[model samples]
Target: MKVSTIEPAQPLDHLAPAGRIGVVALATDFNIEQDLRRMLPGDTQIFTSRVRNYNPLTIENLRSMAPGISAAADTILPGTQLDAIIYGCTSGTVAIGSERIAELIHQSCPGVPVTNPVTAAVAAFRQLGARRISILTPYTEQVNCEVAELFQRHGFEVLNIAGFGFEDDTAMTFISPVDIVNAAKNVCDAQADLLFVSCTALRASVVLDEIEAQLGKPVVSSNQALTWHSLQLLGYPAPVSGYGSLLQQLPV
Candidate 1:
């Protein structure tokens, strides 16, 4: 028998040389991971961990996820570098508050840029110069009101907000793209400068452009905004097109 050690033929490049992103998704969410991965650059790497969440979606249920936030963030590439960390919940972000979410994530990832759907949506709207926005969600009126208030606090006019009155997160993922488009079109205010489809559970990314072309206004979805903002934070140069104007309009 013989044993030998030899030098490698070539030096190895860094893992995820293009970029690496961390996603803290909800235990009940079924759409955010795939939607975000599909929209991110081909060379970019995605790492995801799920936080515990209560169903029958309500403000109380959403806020219940707060305790698991730091644990979920810590599991994703611990002691390593991630360009950004995304807490992939729109209502949950509103429920727990974005500042607190960032603080929780930073408890583990310390200084890594943290983003959520609501924060990402605000940045998307600001980048597109949209002050008047109409919203579509899969939550009940109570959750919808909180989302509206969050945006209002950011100084954007909430033209209108409509919801599917869904209580289960799994059911929200099953919402058909056609139905989402129809609801978005109907819910959007005539005077709105943009339409925001709010929910990580809703599969809205595939139809963002379709709705935009029909309504002649920019469309931003939860997963779309999160991925777009992560890419921007990473300073990835390539433009991600076909989803919506929010992704394509990356700053130079």
Candidate 2:
């Protein structure tokens, strides 16, 4: 037997040389990661960890996932630095509270900026000077009410809110983008400044521009807003177009 050994290649630059973003997604979610990957810059990297989620997609079920947030966050590149971490849930953030979620994530990834869909959506709305907004969701009326109230508390007048009455997180991902556009148009108020489509499990990113073109108003979705806000925290200033108006606004 003969053995040959070659010298190892020189250490290469970090794989995520541009930026590293971590996501703590719901175990049942099938859309957020995919949407984020498609939206972010090619040089940037995405790392994800999933937290166990309860079924039926109720507030209680959503809140059940809260305890494991820190553990899920720690699993995403432990002992390494991340430009930002995203808690990829919309209704879950409303159920558990965005501030509390950020605190839990900080327990593991201390000093790292943490954001969730709800918070990011609010920021996107404010940045676009949208004081009156309408909403569309895949959740039942109960969850829809909470989402509307959360936005109202943030000082934005809720022009209208509508939903598809879905309860399964996984099923929500299968919602057709065309249906989302139609529902958004139906729910959006003519007088409102913007429309927000809530739900991380819904595939809203790919059709945002088309919706905007048809509605003649800006549209913000859970996955799109979260990606935009994460890029903002990472200091990525590129004006990303084709997704929607929010991404092209050039975060400061």
Report the C-alpha lDDT of model 2 over 96-192, residue by residue, as the tens digit: 9998999999999999999999889989998999999999999999999999999999999998899999999999999999899889878999999
Return the clash pairs for model 1, or none: none
Model 1 segments more than 4 A misplaced: 1-7
lDDT of 1 by residue, 128-187 (tens): 999999999999999999999999999999989999999999889999999999998899
**lDDT value, candidate 2, whole model:** 0.92
RMSD of each: 1.3, 1.4
Q: What C-alpha lDDT do the candidate models reach, one value each?
A: 0.91, 0.92
> After superposition, which runs of candidate 2 have C-alpha atoms over 4 Å from their true positions?
1-11
Residue 215 alpha-carbon offset, candidate 2, angstroms: 0.7
Q: Total clashing residue pairs per candidate?
A: 0, 0
- Give the clash total for candidate 1: 0
